[model samples]
Target: MKKTIITISREFGSGGREIGKKLAEQLNVPFYDKELIEIAAKESGLDKELFEEEDSRTSKGFRLLGALGYSLGGPLSTITELSLNDRLFLVQSQVIEQVAKEGACVIVGRCADYVLKDYDTVLNVFIHGNMKEKKERAIHSYEVDERDIENSIHKIDKRRANYYEYYTDRKWGRAENYDISLNSSTFGIDGCVEIIKEVAVNKSL
Candidate 1:
């Protein structure tokens, strides 16, 4: 395929990652998800645990900032005094750009869509699902605790949204921010993969 990059932004429990992985397999390209963290850690010579910790703390960090009466300026507002999260974001973005420059890859999360916004051959997709179905999927597919499944789903989604918005200055899951916004509940995982693959292939051709 001629499409060099595909970035997927997804709601919690939406199977967006799965769709991305399957599409990459079909298109014969590299896939990056948690792998981005690994790549960033290695390339930046930072502890992998640091990246993982900051990666998971985006929402809590935002809340802490709010509690401290901080503004919601973008992550790079203070270049000289960067937080660990900011540092990780910078390294991660570098890795993303390097990989995109090298060749085709499917990237999930990490605000890759915004990072590669200038790429002419990139397709950015957002995946969402009905609340009821998402809860069910979380419990069964993702093995989330049933007792707090609903709360967990919302919390994770909030975390993702905060992370994307904080770094990219764009609203996460917003249709205008993505080339394609799909409903997993409407199209299912395989269907979503096929549709995205078709679009990517046609764009490449």
Candidate 2:
């Protein structure tokens, strides 16, 4: 069987990360989330904190070379300096490509759906759940601050959507952008995993 690459974009506090993990485990593929940040930091020799900051915020998301998944061929001499956000984006593109090349993998967030657009046999999925369901997941599964969970959810989702749109030139959460969309609240995590598995199987056929 051929390898498959799955990129999952999700709303904040929606248990998307967890769903990706479970799906990868079920599919017996590697799962990548925050691991991309460390890879970028290591490859660029930048501070991990810097990458983390860039990873979450959308302010500097629109940088040159972000449009086409920064070319990995040239030496570092061409670009004199890179902002943390740009460096992270470039490095992520490299890492995402490398991992997908090795074999099947499930990648969560970081606008991976856009970065891996050129790769064949890639499944771009969006995972979202109802606000109430997400709020509970945020507090329980993610251990988010309970005091102001509502605003936190909205704020984080906005950042993700903005970063995605800024980098990819595509609207986030739009049905047309992805191959499959799932509401985790409807069938829960495992069910979503099965749904994706079926779709992936069909795609392979």
- RMSD to the hidden true structure, all candidates: 7.0, 6.7
RMSD of 2: 6.7
Weakest lDDT window of 10 consecutive positions for candidate 1: 62-71
List, in order, the clash count of every candidate structure: 0, 0
Residue range 73-127, candidate 1, lDDT tens digits: 7342342344777656666766777788989899998888887888888998999
Please report the candidate that would top TM-score against the real structure.
Answer: 1
Candidate 2 residues 162-189, lDDT tens each? 7887666688999998988999999898
- Model 2 — which ten-residue stretch has the worst lDDT? 55-64
